[model samples]
Target chain A: MKPKRTGKPEAAAVDRDHALHLLRAMTRIRRLEEKCAELYSAMKIRGFLHLYDGQEAVAVGVMQALTPEDAVVATYREHAHALIRGVSAGSILAEMYGKQEGCSRGRGGSMHLFDQETRFYGGNAIVGGGLPIAVGLALADKMQGRVRVTCCFFGEGAVAEGEFHESLNLAVLWQVPVLFVCENNLYAMGTALEFEHAVTDIARKAACYDLPSTAVDGMDVLAVETAAARAVAAVRAGEGPQFLECRTYRFRAHSMYDAELYRSKDEVRQWKKRGPIATFTQKMKRRGRLADADVKAIEGEVAREIEGAVAFAEACTWEPVEDATRFVYSEGRMP
Target chain B: MIDGEQALRTITYREAVREALREALQKDERVFLMGEDVGRYGGCFAVSKGLLEAFGPERIRDTPLSESGFVGAGIGAALGGMRPIVEVMTVNFSLLCADQIINNAAVYLYMSGGQFNVPLVIRLATGGGRQLAAQHSRSLEGWYAHIPGIKILSPATVEDARGMLWTALQDPDPVLIFENSGLYNMEATLGADAGPVDIHQARVRRAGRDISIITYSASLYKALEAAETLAKEGIEAEVIDLRTLRPLDERTFLESVARTHRALIVDEGWRSGGISAEIASRIMEGAFYELDAPVARLCSQEAPMPYAKHMEDAVLPQAAGIVDLVRHMVNAHG
Candidate 1:
């Protein structure tokens, strides 16, 4: 096959396997979310379904830089992060289905996915809520002499919250190892970033705390990976926290309930033209790193995985109503 | 346990709390106290005075005036496998950190499918007095007690002030200890050997049969004083200090009410939706038939705390108020 041109300057250096892996991960997220939207329409997956249809590159790219030992604190729109961080797609689907076998025992549905084995702290529903928790986790790691990083993920809207500023200050002052990833998708559930923040340049906000920061093309998986690798490295080296602003766009509504009245179709169409999966796949195929056949194979595999996950979720049992109050306190510790 | 050979030292409630913090820091490497002015400023109320020198800055950490930030960090630290004691200056200011305390710290364990338990101890000065006014003197422990995943402690006495911190640190859940702002200077003998006390039950401060005066925190003193005054009048009153408020040692208070047949709840918080209402509800539920008179509650007036000393005293449940209420209850029933 004749090798085509690499349209983007940053896509030229991409390797075959790495490109394929990134493509597979993003494809997996896209398929899973497509299935989730289906389930929500069918009245299966209830509550808020913040699909990561257009923001897959950020989670996939960032997860590549983290180790299994490290901790992750993500926001409600975190299915992609949880999946890329080695939480089973089955469990993620189960959690969305509100099954007892779900990651959080079905107690926390779509927005509260928690996996202790993987150290995925939560699916924090509140904006900017996980930032301080990430700081404390990093503080614990520093105090315990562990050289691990705690990555906190939030939206650009979170920059306006008091906890965000407070967390950044604490992380910088205490020299805790934390990577604050702000996925700026332009809108925070109908509120545009311009409307929400006085300083829309999210990285500059972190800079006010004297923390090193970088803003990257969140649509390009390679760009996000490179920036996150550098930030995570500096944090793990004990240079203190780093802020990452992933400038991306979400093609779908903020939630299933959103009307998209805040933005126009021309704006959505413009962003969807530069969608992460299509752009990344085309770049890979043009560079001869991935072929059309490889893309088809990856899609088939993801389809089977999503189908199996849906089956697992459908078969999962419900927690008895009698045990509703069992976990309010630690039953194992207190008599 | 109190030892005979060891001498009992009389210390203020502030000193006892500081001693407990010191003991926790020394006993466990994971235990640390972080709050505003706790280190360099020696605590807002001087409860952690000299702890910075004793435990150094890392363990006796002083945070900026970001209650939500530090308190949420405390929850995170606890989840990260460290026992952190977060001190908010007062319950009034705790509203700033209420989201972290009520939403994150109190709900994480249950919401996380019981996989993550926040072994955090949050100690805040609560209750009214000293003319700090509305912003500084609100008794909001009742608000925290309404939360599920966290335990509530009101350490009214010196022994509890010294002992409850260690026990709260041991529990594999979040515990909030409310130290009344009024009790910091109150002095009593604390056994040198005083250590971790049971944080699961209420303790009877005085024994009587005429009426049961149930209370916690600083109001325990008022109930005790009322019991003494009633004793002199030949109308004996029992005083129950509810050390643990959330799990509520209902058995102890219910048994006391069963014997006394009349109950009076003295709380520094407001009457409606306060801890007094909860105690009254429990009594009505468990000891409904064991009542000679209605289970009365003496609480602060339903209004924002005033700055004037006399007005503040009039609003709160004072010793005189408890005495007057108990005398009225006994007289009406007799």
Candidate 2:
């Protein structure tokens, strides 16, 4: 269901702790991404910094429904996903900093963060590349009789890739449990949705492959979480593949390099008014689940955390150039 | 010359490969064979003819005509802790999934900072000689060998055909085994207990002192034939079969070149930027001082493989051409 743009977040059923947890999650992503932009500007990070600015609700809500056992494959614009999936903020920043202490050991910069401990598959840079990987991960789980879901996140742009069609078909054909999440942030690089997809409705495209799909208001944290929980439960129950099209928008440019000539300031300003963090914060305050002091405390705590992460990243050491060729093949193996 | 206790059986190369797949599936529960027509259709070239009935459908899977999808799924399966043997019908079709093989399977371990290892094996029929024409016929193993993160294996003999698959599956990284379509029907004697073989070294198929005929896959047989013809004329040529193309056993061939004082590379792939070119360059870099004459290569003609038999034959490197090249190198050097 489309979220009401004017009403308070339907918070009547949400308890205090859960409401605050969701608020903190969104706040953490927002603060972390804001810092990442500053770092990119300061030249502390380089090579295509895609901040997950206006879409915090999607990652925050979806992650709330996933277990640690589930695998996640996300796009290059995945700093928020990685952070929400429990990759330490320090490691994520260090990865962008190209440090050996980074989660990907500095080998993968911004677009290739990977953490085996979290079962996070990668920060895949190619559009539509992670769909097949997620299918295969779920295929392995199904073959081995493991009850787990593999959540894959991509942009609406990936809907145009053949791998998307092939993966959905294979997922249902083989009956693997994978949740395909399309973060429809409207623009793929500089191209608009209409310019890329003939059908702007991304969820309907998943229906073509007989996949059960839902289009949730990506700006509403509760909406995304509800849809994701249902989808994840069905996938875990071996209901084959499920797809969620999160209708969202990116407040920042597509990348640090983009001028965003395809979009306008007016449109960006309108989306910002519906920004996930602000709307959710205002709704919780209105419901009396939070106060001005609570928001202030949360902001202060998140700010300190971001500072600590930045400090950790700044102190991390560079990987020795001698080890540059190390991971090309696994170490301690005959190449 | 055989030991009385050990029994040997004669089998076709196709049977040997099937035996390897059957052994791998039986040995490891995590091992499965996946590709188009690998199940009910019994493989494109019938290499996996009876596997589906033997191992059942789960282990012997048949995928749709989505090369990139299945191949990427193979990479994902490998990451998720299963040893997958993905087969593309031929090297020509592998292009559709080159992104998966080169980008995903190959770079996963490295890009992930060694957190994940893709224990995946890709098997595909390579080379031309069946008049499958340009679209179906290709010898692009050399192009794959150019990639760093994966290993390339060309099984020219029955023993290698029977043994390489299991060894490749054991590798922590991805390995692409190129089974030349031309050699699938060749028959040879192999021990009944024949199992996994080393995939790291070049094997000396024939020993001599005059020249080193370096080749692999189906071209190895042609080089051996040329060596036999040259041996009859009193010019003994050592034949080196490069079983592993990527991490090439340059030491074996370099040592052979040092003793023989001359080298001639025979490959089915085109000469320009092919494995032959890499081997020649390596020889020049490693054993140039030991050579009595400059190294030479006999590769397929720089053109698309034709459908007609005579035109195809004219394009490929034949035994006669190898013999003539060896004769000229030996005679002129002497």
Candidate 3:
């Protein structure tokens, strides 16, 4: 794990200890996701594996800036978000494998991972479906006076959904504590952002709702954390909601199912040059915050975590055929 | 847990629902209400009247007209550990929330593979007789009953209206309680108090041995009236009210059919592929030997209910319509 300034305008409030913690959390997510890619090719995992290969900084940076009381809502491209928020890597991977040991009991498959303890709401498969849910969670928190921020992460393409506008209005109107973090990877599946949206500046739309918003270079982990920290602070101070437009990109295709018809090889190459994990590692090596030995140790630790998850899933029992009729009605007392 | 017996009360359909909401909110800290006008508006039918003043705004929430948004939010709230009672105003309005109700909430329990249980209760006023016209008046509970992983109940009597909500709340899956607008003011006298009604069984409201009349919701009384009129003519007709539509009580239905060897399904839904058709088909499929004659059915006319009062009376099933249909069936069977 390493922390490098990367020429980002450092928020002076961020101390060395906090920076180190963010770096470790980000490394864990980056390594776990990197392993998932290999696992996908090995046929150990199947279904729609939308890897956050390049955009690890957005989830790690933003989540590290929030408190434990916060609730997280995310899209299908959210393995990084769940891991960064403390959901066990084994649970997420087993869920991807569609095993009962996984979070959501393998019911949600790759897209609906939920950890009630982590306050990680779901891996909502619908493009913009998780936004309103985030608002509802924020509403519940506000009404209960829990003083916990509800941080929601979605792709840049989610801007096209009706739920996006509806959730924004409700969150701002109610003065709820919501940090709407848009992991703007600049593409929605096979379609590029410019081709679909009339206005490319997503933060300006947040302004339309009279809400405060910010746009940040999502590749730089330290930069994202600085912006997220300020925004999270403002929202927690009862200043209503704040939107952080993370200018990032996914290195892989939208999903495993995509044939890669939309983007050019040049575009993928360009985004890869700024990949969060690689960029952060280079800076950390330069700053003496990390060593070659430390990197190996981190990778070894992550490999073991994933191995444990696979073993756990293998040992998991399938729900009995008769039990299929069990949870359908929670009121089992009925005659 | 509140004892089901003592909680039951003999009241009008409207008051019974109000008491249920109040009790649910009081009984559980996790229970809350959210809908289009559930708060300051006092509910469209005042079924949740004084709830806002009693439970305050936290428990009784008012939402914008975006049905999909609010209903979807209710599902999320349920997932977030709160029991939400979402009122859709009317079944006609539920169309707007269909995506959230049908796609999201209905399938969430199974889709999550038992990781989550949506203890959500969606209450809406359904059926016709208010002369609210085509857009406002339609019985669409049948369409919802088509979905899996959800429980559907159409409560016509006061006991059902009151008891169904509690049962729905106790159930882990999403439950939609459709209360007919026409039955709101109708009162019922249940001995000293309304008995705790089970949401899963068919109740034999009237007894006879010659012919069986199966119906539910607003059409229950009409079918019973038809049965009474037939008794005067020496035609014994049994009436069964199907309280819940989703888990259809086939045993009770088949038992009645097997005994009388005749069935007349009365429904307020449109004639094409309606619930009545389902009942007739089930009887034919399961108990073919019991039939004295092919199962008869009397359903609403296949036209969009017209606004004219006389036209409305003509299109829907009435006591006279059921009575005439039963007489024809009886004559044919005899």
Local accuracy of candidate 2 as per-residue lDDT tens digits, A189-229: 99999999898888888887888888889999988988888
Between which residue pairs do clashes occur in model 2? Answer: none
Interface RMSD of each: 1.0, 1.3, 2.5
Question: What TM-score goes with each of the models?
Answer: 0.97, 0.97, 0.89
For residues B1-334, could you state the per-residue lDDT of candidate 2 as single tens digits? Answer: 6675357888999999999999999999999999999999999889999999999988999999999999999999988989999999999999999988888888988888999989899999999988888998799999999998999999999999999998898899999999998898999998889999999999999999999999999989898888899989999999999999988899999999999999999989999999999999999999989999989999999999899999999999999999999999999998
What range of 10 consecutive residues in model 3 chain B has the weakest lDDT sum?
B188-197
Candidate 3 on B85-170: residue-level lDDT in tens?
A: 98998888888778777767766666656556677889988898677778887988776777777888989788788778877887
- Give the Cα error of residue A79 in candidate 1, in Å: 0.7
- On TM-score, the stronger of 1 and 3 is 1
Point out where model 3 deviates above 4 Å. A1-7, A11-31, A34-44, A67-69, A307-322, A331-335, B1-11, B26-29, B190-196, B271-274, B301-314
Model 1 chain B: weakest 10-residue lDDT segment is: B1-10
Interface DockQ of candidate 2: 0.74
TM-score of chain A of 3: 0.91
- The parts of candidate 1 lying over 4 Å away from their true place are A1-9, B1-6
Ranking of all candidate structures by their DockQ, best first: 1, 2, 3
The numbered model that scores best in lDDT is 2
